[model samples]
Target: MLKIFLSSTYRDLVEYRAKILDKLDTVFDSVGMEEFIPDGKTSHEICIGDLKKSDIVIFLLSSNYGSLIDVCRLKEDCKAECPMKTGESHISYTHCEFKTVIAEGILHQTYKVLKGWDTQDKKEAILFEEEF
Candidate 1:
């Protein structure tokens, strides 16, 4: 089975993520932080490890950049000083996952969700491309 990693901000893409899972469930093994990460393991560790094992990584970019909450630290104080190219003071966990996917030289694709546009068409395009 092809192991696929779905990366996105949870709050913004919950419905989209569900739809993807529904489609992928029959054909591929899908891993998303919301459904796959176990309670005992640290999210950072699991994300990087699973991402490396995945056949492909798909990133969903939406309007909200999302917030970074440190799972390891108490009181969510941790912030990653992202590289200059990222153009941000701090990076979220989702950002870290993206970087990991890149650093590991994993097969990946990204799709941007335009505001007020039909997402279903864009999602279908992404899925179609992935199929071939």
Candidate 2:
């Protein structure tokens, strides 16, 4: 079973995680980083441990545009814990790294929206063509 870490701005995408999980569980054995960590545990050790166990990281970028908390403000925290690129805005980081990771021939790449019937089952199940 593939393990995937789905990263998105907490303030905006937290609710969306449930919808994504419903679809993901249909095929992959997965866990959300927030779910695995005990409440109030913000240590890098726990976060990185979960990240390390993940086989792929899917970033839900567009979903975070209206986030009130501004996850970018927590850049230092994320940098200390996660494998994602820091400093750059979330969307930029997603766009930049997607190509580099794919060029380096890493995990399967995708960038289009994928949540419930809003995204067709056939499209969601199949890997995307090129970058999104």
Candidate 3:
């Protein structure tokens, strides 16, 4: 079975992620941060490990950048066209995963949410809290 790693901002893309999992979880070996449990590994390392193991990746990009992580080491290790700016201290987890997939040559697809579609992440968080 082909494993798919879903990458996106948790808050803004909650609905989209849930929908994708609901629709695709059974059809494919779908893995995302939601399913991750603490295993004595940093999120960056865990995500990178998962991305390497996945056969393909699906990225849902939005205006939100997600949590910014220090990418100094990861950036240095990348051999692909990482769009990181010079002297940048941090990069978002979503962006990091996206870059890692590219750097490792993993098959991937991306769905971009329109900028005009406002992010109601805060409100959605409360409404969906424990709802799923």
Candidate 4:
């Protein structure tokens, strides 16, 4: 079975995420922070490791950029600042996950969902039109 890693801002897309999971559950196994991440593993380790194991990645984007965290800064060995930490950098966990997947040269697709709108309706409509 193919493993799919779903990437998106959790708080911003709770409803959309649930709908995606429900749709994906019938076909492929899906991985996300809420129901998949194992205990004892750090967020960075879990995300990167799981992303590496996944066959494909799906990104859900919105107007909200979400929160950012400096993984390099948190490490004791790395003294250099995170390259993504710039004046206009809105590197959320979802962003980092997407970057990691790209850096690994994995297959990915992105879908834009409007913020403050009915995400389930938008997602369902889009998925229905797409091959998926």
Candidate 5:
């Protein structure tokens, strides 16, 4: 079975996550970070386990939540995006939703979809067939 890790904050992206999960379930076995992480679990534990078990980790980036570290490194510690300041707003960056896809460690082949976006190239899609 193909394993995938879906990572995103619990507040904003629930609906988007559900859509992605539904599509992924049709093709591959998948898990989300929230399943293993509950009210009391430490962030470190959940993050580590999720990254370790998943063959590919899909991080859904948002304008206020983009990670600063390069995607090429799969390690836990990286510079996090600066926390948004209240009472003062700044101009947002372009393509903020999918900015996390090109991080230092991410492979170019893995997908990076923004909100309401669909895969345009089916020829490069990953298909799994049962072992003979």
Candidate 6:
């Protein structure tokens, strides 16, 4: 059976994920982070594991960069554990996923979400694409 992985900003694409899962599950073994459990690893780590197993990956991108590996501002105790490392800057989970897709040479497709992006956020995804 073909395995497909879906990636996107969760909140904004909740509806999108549902609709696509409904359609693809009929024909493919489609999966995403929604099926994931809190299994001692971070969400980012879990996703990279799933992404490696996928036959194809479909990325739903918007102006929204999505969640961070560790949300410092949102957590009062998050200290210095959340900032991007020097000489290495990836603003969101989706950004890391995009880079991994390329590095792994995975067959993938990206669909721009015109409805969900937050116009106020920085366009870091586009910045990475620009380097390509």
Each prediction's Cα RMSD?
8.0, 8.4, 7.7, 7.6, 11.7, 6.3
Cα deviation of 47, candidate 1, in Å: 1.9
At residue 1, candidate 5 shows an lDDT of: 84
How high is the lDDT of residue 46 in model 4?
72
Candidate 2 stretches with Cα past 4 Å from truth are 39-43, 63-132
Q: Which ranges in model 3 have alpha carbons more than 4 Å from their true place?
A: 71-86, 115-132
> How many pairs collide in each candidate, listed in order?
0, 0, 0, 0, 8, 0
* Best prediction by lDDT: 6
For model 4, name the residue pairs that clash: none
Can you tell me which runs of candidate 6 are displaced by over 4 Å? 71-87, 116-121, 125-132
lDDT of each: 0.66, 0.48, 0.72, 0.68, 0.44, 0.72
Question: Model 2 compared with the native: what TM-score?
Answer: 0.47
Q: List the residue pairs that clash in candidate 6.
A: none
Residues 1-132 of candidate 1 have per-residue lDDT tens digits of 999899887887899999997788779999887776476867767776687889999888765555654443312322323342344334566666665666667899888766634544444234323432
- Candidate order by decreasing lDDT: 6, 3, 4, 1, 2, 5
lDDT for predicted candidate 6 compared with the true structure: 0.72
Per-residue lDDT tens digits for candidate 6, residues 3-104, read 999988888788999999889999999989889888987776677788888999998886666776663132232122323543245367776667667767
Query: Which residues of candidate 5, in runs, are more than 4 Å off?
Result: 37-41, 66-132
Best by TM-score: 6
User: Residue 61 CA error for candidate 1 (Å)?
Assistant: 0.5
Task: Name the TM-score of candidate 4.
Answer: 0.71
Error of 6 at 30 (Å): 0.5
Residue 54, candidate 4: C-alpha displacement in angstroms: 0.4
lDDT, residue 123, candidate 3:
39
